[model samples]
Target chain A: MLEKTGLPTDDDLKKVIPDKERLAKGAVVIIECFQKIPCDPCAISCQFGAIKPFKDINDLPQVDFNKCTGCGICISACPGLAIFVIDNNYSENKALIKLPYEMLPLPEKGKEVYALDRAGKIVSKAKVVRVQKIKNKTNIISISVHKNMAMKVRSIKVEDKKNEG
Target chain B: MKKTNLAIIGGGPAGLSAAICAASSGAKITLIDDSLELGGQLIKQTHKFFGSKKQFAGIRGIEIAKNLLQEIKKYKNIELIGNATVTGYYEDGILTIVQGSNGDIFIKLLPDRIIVATGASENMLTFVNNDLPGVYGAGAVQTLMNLYGVVPGNNVLMVGAGNIGLIVSYQLLQAGIKVEAIVEALPRIGGYLVHASKIRRLGVPIYTSHSLKEVYGNDGVEKAVISEINKDFEFIPGTEKELKVDTVCLAVGLSPLSDLLWQAGCQMKYIAELGGYVALRDDHMKSSLDNIYIAGDVAGIEEASSAMLEGKIAGLNAAVSLGYRVDNFLELNRNLRKELEELRANPLSEKVKIGLEKALLKREVDQ
Candidate 1:
């Protein structure tokens, strides 16, 4: 018998996805922390208190969209690299996405990168707008992709050395 | 025989924290490790940790090791010794440690209190061609890729779906290594869902109810074959599929290294939940043997965070036994236990609870 595999499905995504109004407002946090594990660095990293304190360590984090300023500090603070900030209001045809990146040869600002979805398939072309290496642990990289690709994109393709050469 | 107040067997997170805490409590501490540098497995863990700030959350494991090493250096009473292996623990708190590469140097230490924190060893799956050179432990892969910057192989087949398997799969991607697949005999992912999600999102297929049946190669691992298994873990007929891969990484499980505990005559019991035979210890981490304590994986296999907490408790209590007045010992112990409880309260921690209960039951029986 097949059992629950733990990967997020569309149904699971619906639970943590920001509302239409919040998504349209341009800045929102999408927490993909599906498991009830003992982790809460995201809550403490949020300066606006948007991420509520977990009643229990295994409790799912609740995000008050109103208080969330989308400062993106929690992007790097998340040990799981599951917290993401998306802004649909970047432009009429583009959206901004900030993800935790930890690979070497960090992507540079204004560089073109391939945005990959949950399955790691290249979904759209994206441009790196910002790369912040905080405390040399989790690096927060913000990229601008097509508005429709904002919700689908999770990571940027790291250029392989051999491929680069 | 030189006398010391305390002798800590391992210098990983547990031993490092114990050395710092014990030394701070006025006990002369001698911390010895088998590695050239300290930080046991922490040296290879590149991912950030999750916990409260008090536990140094948001910090990478490598950074945590560096910070702990720096903190331990502050105490003049604690002596840090690397490249030393504790060969044996004998009667009267005597420890025979062989130092140097050739094991030529022998040092006999007689400490009033001994803390066994000698971590654990990775478990390997038994199968055809399992002895091939390319077949490596998941920890060895991390040590090679993350620590030594050597790519384990171009293509890898991870043979476990636990935290180590999932985390190593992600790290393999970080090192630009391709993970062909992860085959687990369990019906579902055994680790945290977040870890499984991370690797799944990276397009790594996790095959549950599947087991690595054979590793095919002559000089090294050239390919691997997996098959579906039944509830009894018996391989189903006509379900085998060969995976083209160069490396077969095993993350089956970890067995606690409790040889010294047994040699020292500490009461040991076979507890499957604790991942093998473990020394019986009270909540204070003191074994049935007087002045001998156990912590970290040596006591039971658990996360680094819990191991560090166990080390601190054992260290504080050991100091107290050594006539050191630890002002906040009780309060600190209570808080540490609370934090450990919080970390272990998840539904997935039911097994951990069972393991802890078995170990604790033995402790009560001994008392």
Candidate 2:
């Protein structure tokens, strides 16, 4: 399904998503990597040992949700940009999602942007909460969206004034 | 004529790694490259590499080039010659090199050992008006944008959805350029699903089972016509779609640049899986010729990580053959081979593994 549409299927997400108790607890990391490729930066960059050591370099990353503090350090380290951190307990009706942002002209903190789902459709309007730029150019952006849309929203589109119709 | 222990042609990842490895064993190495800069294609790669830490995974290719150059600088025995192209490898054991902006100067070297890591060249697609002024290869696009900081065009129609196409499409978006679409002949994307997902989530559409029918323009590219292809790669009638775009990028594939090897009289085999004709070499990267070695894409088309490992193997063996002392030679050789095996263990590398099997020659007797 992923090869056909270029979007991970629901079945793929079910294997990596944290359970209800872990979601209710606090922030945690979710690795969306599906295929086996020779990549291990997520395992090497984890400071808390949440991501288990790879027996082989080609093994997909497996994270122990209980050990993960959702610090978002490994978000930018993923070469495929397939890692994210979500805090379902951010507020009564809102959740915080930290995703890798690599496009130019970084959106300002607290700016409102269109939150997009895995299929790249605008699902809801979200507010940018934090913008952390690291030396490697893969910046980390934190956005606040409705609690129900947390899992669906995976990217953002900064509304350009010139492109507005 | 000047002489050295080893001469490496091409200052790309493969040649640079070979120089570092051989120089560490106290062998005098002369590394030559045609480009003014030393990194070859690695200099233009902006995306992070995928592999373990030994290959600099998670680091950008541009950064890896810098690191390799820095490593080469620490070894005083390795001399770098940039903007110099090795013209021919003579049967009399002499290599003719042409340097200078106009290629007026000529120099000859008679090294005890030679390691050819000339890399590969991009393959072009055949379609009507494909030679238009605006048409470009994926490597050209990367060189223009990542190296020279010049955007190729406002909008681009990409052909071939392999890793190069997908990564270039993402890079185009990063540079604030618009990607019209990506067309691949295969029904499924040939690149990693994650790379496709990266651009898909950014609002780029990848059309599978589609091939570029043609491009039309007076002086430059104005539009592209694409149609769905069947299992045999033939276009399906009445399924044509036209897209408005200014540029077209071809990322079909690459063929090994093994001209020097052919000239040097190394046993060659035409392996389609390896991208083209590649030199047959032993486990240690030694060619049929006693003092000649091959590594990287020159031996077979593979990822930069594998190229680096091959360069290490070739360099170590080349130096050892020249009677240079290396600490724990067998252990080092075994570890390098094991790392290479691990790198190619994934299913994605199946094609490369098969190609390597055919290109690798078995020793009749251990030297």
Candidate 3:
């Protein structure tokens, strides 16, 4: 389904999502990479021993949820931009999602934007909470969305006037 | 006439790695490239590479080129020749080169060993008005935007769903250009899903099982027509759709630039899976001729990581053939081979594996 639609199917997402108990706790990393490509940067970038060591470079990353602190260091390190950090305990009705953003005109903090789902459909309105520009061009942007839309919102679109430039 | 132990043609990732490996093992090297600066296509790639850590996984291609150049600088035995083109390689072991701004300078080299690492050229598609001024290859677009910071056009239609097409679309957005859509002839997206997802979430629609019907304009591209295709690649008559765009980028595929190998008379075969004609070589990358070596896209179309690994193998083997004293030669050679095997072990590399099987020549028992 991912090959045809370019978006992971529910079955694909089911394999990588943390259990309900883990989600209720705090922030955790979600790797949406389902292919067997020859890459292992996530394991190397993780400070904690959450991502298991890759027996072969082509092996998919195996994350140990117990050790995962969801520091979000691996978000920008992924070349595919397939990794994300979800914090369900952000607020009573809001959740925070950290994603890799490489586009220009970085969204200003506290600015409202349209949050999009996997297929790029507008799902909800979100506010930018954090924008960390790393040494690499892949910057990390965290947005606070409705708690029910935490897993669905994967990207944000800013409608600033300057973006027309 | 100038002479060296090993002469590397094309200063891309493969050639740079070859020069560094051979030079470190005491084989004086002359690394030649047509561009004034080195790094070939890598200098223009903005996206990070995907491979193991040893191959610099998660590092941008531009940074990888920088690291290779810095590593090459450490080898005093290595000499770099820029703005120089290797014109011909004669049977008598002489290579003619043309250098200088006007290409008026002529030079000859009689190196003991020659490694051909010439890369690839982008393939163009056939369609009405494809020759318009606004039409461009993906590589040209990358060179223009990433290298010179020049945006190609306001709106564009990409003609492939491969990694290059997807990545270039993302880059165009970064450059503030609007991507109308992407059309691919295949039913399923040919590139990695992650790359497709990256662009899709940004609102660029990819039309699989679709082909560019035509482009129409007076002096430049003003609009494009695309239509859905069937399993046999036949265009569906009523499925045509028009998109207004100033530029059309073709990222269909690439063919190996193996003219030097053909001139050298190394046994060659046309392998569609490999992207074109490639030189038949052994595991060490030695061509039919004892002193001739081949690597990178010239040997077979593959990723930069595999190309770098092949370069190391070819460089070390070429040096060893010249009696260079490398204490751990066998061990290093085995490790490089293992790494290359691991890199190509995935299902994505199935085509490359099939191509290699046909191009790989068996080594004789008596060297």
Model 2 DockQ (Cα-based): 0.81
RMSD of each: 2.2, 1.3, 1.4
C-alpha DockQ of every model? 0.57, 0.81, 0.77
Q: Is candidate 1 or candidate 3 better by lDDT?
A: 3
Model 2 lDDT per residue over B315-358, tens place: 99999999999999999999999999999999899999999999
Candidate 1 residue-wise lDDT, B169-214, digit = tens: 9899888789999999989888767777667667788899999999
* Backbone clashes in model 3, listed as residue pairs: none
Against the true structure, what is model 1's DockQ?
0.57
- Separate clash counts for every candidate: 1, 0, 0
Q: What share of the reference contacts survives in each candidate?
A: 0.58, 0.72, 0.65
Candidate 2 on A59-155: residue-level lDDT in tens?
9999999999999999999999999999999999999999999986788998999999987889999999999998888999999999999999999
lDDT of 3 at B318: 96
lDDT of 3 by residue, B181-261 (tens): 999999988887889988888878889999999999998999999999999999999999999999999999989999988
Alpha carbon lDDT of residue B95, candidate 1? Answer: 89
Comparing 1 with 3 on DockQ, the higher-scoring candidate is 3
